[model samples]
Target: MDGDFWAPPPDVSPPVPGVSEGYPGVSQVMSHGYFQHGGVTFPGLLYSPRSLEAAREFPVEDDDVFNVTYQKSGTVWMLEILSLIRQDGDPRWCRSVPNWDRGPWLETLLGLRRARANARPRIISSHLPVHMFPKSFFGSKAKVIYTVRDPKDVLVSLFHFARIFRPYRDPGSLGDFMDKFLQGDVPFGSWFQHVRGWLQLRGRENFFWISYEELQQDLRGSVQRLCSFLCHPLSPAALDAVVTNASFAAMSHNPMSNFSLSPGFILDQNRGPFLRKGISGDWRNHLSPEQSRRFDLVYRERMEGPPKNPSGDTKIPPGPPKNPSGVPKSGEDPQGTPKNGGDP
Candidate 1:
């Protein structure tokens, strides 16, 4: 979270010869799934056997709360919000520790013992899919908050994130990245698969879903709802503090919340801030019209056929494309893929 989860410390493994100073084979590491652990394969540059083994044995307390999402989908934002709630709006205390350390990434293995040794109500984060979690976690009473964003925006964000990391190459253009994203060639695998796997568990008593668009549209309201779900309802002033502290401007400027102060997490701060442009529909700025149309088609196909509700009705229905300001009404495309058009 705070530090580079992908870049293990020198003690984990010696730097590969002829590669980057810390990590080796920048392009090759991400282009293929070369690291295997616990009978699963992951992107080599981002994961290691030691970390995965720790993930396999990671303990999940009854009150443990996990903020799970694919990379760049408001993870830090959620971390800040959850931190504020847990700290009762004590900005000073919240700022005392880095957000990543407050809610350590479950898969990184780095600082995990510190996270466990910390206090009760541990807030953990992970980009791992449902199946990758430790076997005990599934049966535990731990709560999980799954965050999702529009696939298009996710691709754009991931593209920019790759550019900032030393282990990833230029990643070509937005089109190339979009193709990799669609084919599940990038880290954490397919966005569709990740969302779908979590959606399947949507009905679980301990599971909750939060859309990035929903957070954008109503941060305060989302925070309240999350608080209620976590059983940590806040007062008016506390809510305001959480909203203010979690804002893009506040987080971007605050090194404690943002990863800016964390070296190795971001390769070059001059290039861009880690909390860059926290908004919806940013895909419109980066993706071409044809690319958008192609992506829409793939999204519709992958998201077709909704999961069922208890009453036998479709949990989600086909609907029109979402406007930039609105959450996607449904993952399905009711009228089929739209023609090459402007941002939705």
Candidate 2:
């Protein structure tokens, strides 16, 4: 991963040796998992274990498959749902495949093309910024399901995740982390840009938006709605099985779905399990009233009107910033980057 993928403090060095290098436009060294392009850094593969020529090349098929979401937003749950749908609700079959293999992130899938070619009804996941997807897949028959969370929860989740997985000397407090997130210093670019870029495509036939909270509240209904969009419906018994398999308690314990041991795949050796609490409103426990208000202000300004592709989960819409710039007026970090290392 590119060291520049993260905006570490000035004193911290790159996490993985030889994985980063100085770029002219970029102020610091970039990591292997991220690449700098046009002054913007993107999450991508820096190298493949196998020859690119020998990698599997699957056909897009013009069928109704999907590009899933960015991380920390119920991605695991969505993957399980996709697996169940593809298996037609066979509990045993769903249990057979690991989450990584079944719904691999697009960047990770590049080296595993051979394994991907054989997977039927291909379900690909991504944390690719909305603007970086393969152009061919955008308007074609393939479908897209973009899932967005309340930015507060996203920042909280990402903070904890970075402490465990990302290469940093320290993970700052919620207040400090929020400062970077607001400044578009977080990985995958600005949260507003991510949402706005996709919402721009709302109402398109191949696009669908879902929320993590709604899926948590109504698994069966969410699955049915997703099936309806794909023109695939599960039999009554199959639906029941999918719901049971997707239960939080069940998935939390399932090795395939749970990301406890997944650190070895892409993260540093000492990082924490991928799935932390898997609960909503975690921010309430960490974000103070003042901090919450600040976040609310930013959210209101960034999302002025109702989401262009509003899912039942989100209640807030976009609005003008409390501050015209959508950021605090002063007394904030002028660096506009995250302080690296430690727990938040």
Candidate 3:
């Protein structure tokens, strides 16, 4: 986990590109302080077109490991687990290095450089959907560990996350946020699309799926599965160390893992800690009965699409946009003709 690679601190004034107008036939959310780039929505102040272009062309090394997830779906947790596994369950690397450095978010400009510069067997993380991911990753021997969570929980988490996160505006009332979420208006685009798109990679030799619910229920088992997937098994004692350090309590307390070390301008820890409750079903407490029902309808409708075949393809509602040739296209976002681009 410890490497000679050291990423520079993010720019005090990071480059936020001037986003172009949304293209025709795509789902564009230029509102809510977000912007459309290649059919996906992103925080305008955080990401740039140059970084995204780099991501599209990043030459994925065969020995690389990718930690992929949608927003607020245990992204940092997975990174910590991977770090521990790389060191055979040593916490020293995890304690000293911030989570972003552990494996930079590949969508950012700094992270893009860090990922490209890292040594082989690198740990690269991203929140990008399949269409937007590096094109080279498709046939590479690289391994991907994707984290899925109940979108309802993701909704609750993202709502709070936007409050303190400098790039996002206050997510507004929970009810309003729910409506926007279902519409895929928030950052990183739609939760349904993200999960559905990545789930399509299941059953591939190099792809492994770990749901937040499953991990919360049996972390040890999940860790074991990860070790098996990565082909880096730990001794029982070492495995114990990994589990102990990666626990929610331990992570929350660690400045490296938590966002406590972040500057106020970037992450306002005063407003909320990045690591909130680690348990599942917290959404139940926050969502009204009506909200829950609506969530269920959307989730079931999309996730329960045409049965997946051996190749892992399934027909999904609002399925990933493709080129006219009828094959999935890389390096593009949804086809969009935007009516407006502001959060109303």
**TM per prediction:** 0.79, 0.72, 0.81
Candidate 1: tens digits of C-alpha lDDT, residues 259-308: 76767643666776677789877777887778777777776666654422
The per-residue C-alpha lDDT of model 2 at residue 192 equals 67
Q: Candidate 2 on 1-344: residue-level lDDT in tens?
A: 01001110112111221111231222233664555442344444432322221221223446636545655767778878878887778766556667767766564445246335645567776665444455456536788777756567788888887676543324477677889888766666577656655544544567676667657656687788777777778899989988888887778778777765555645653655566777766787888878877776665555654433222123333232132233211111224332211111
- TM-score of model number 2: 0.72
Return the top candidate by lDDT.
3
Rank candidates by TM-score, best first.
3, 1, 2
lDDT of 3 at 88: 92
Over all chains combined, what TM-score does candidate 1 have? 0.79
Best by TM-score: 3
Residue runs of model 2 more than 4 Å from their true location after superposition: 1-35, 42-59, 109-116, 167-170, 263-272, 305-344
The candidate with the higher lDDT, 2 or 3, is: 3
**Per-residue lDDT tens digits of candidate 3, residues 88-139?**
9989999998888879889999898888777677999999876678878876
Model 3, runs deviating above 4 Å: 1-33, 306-344
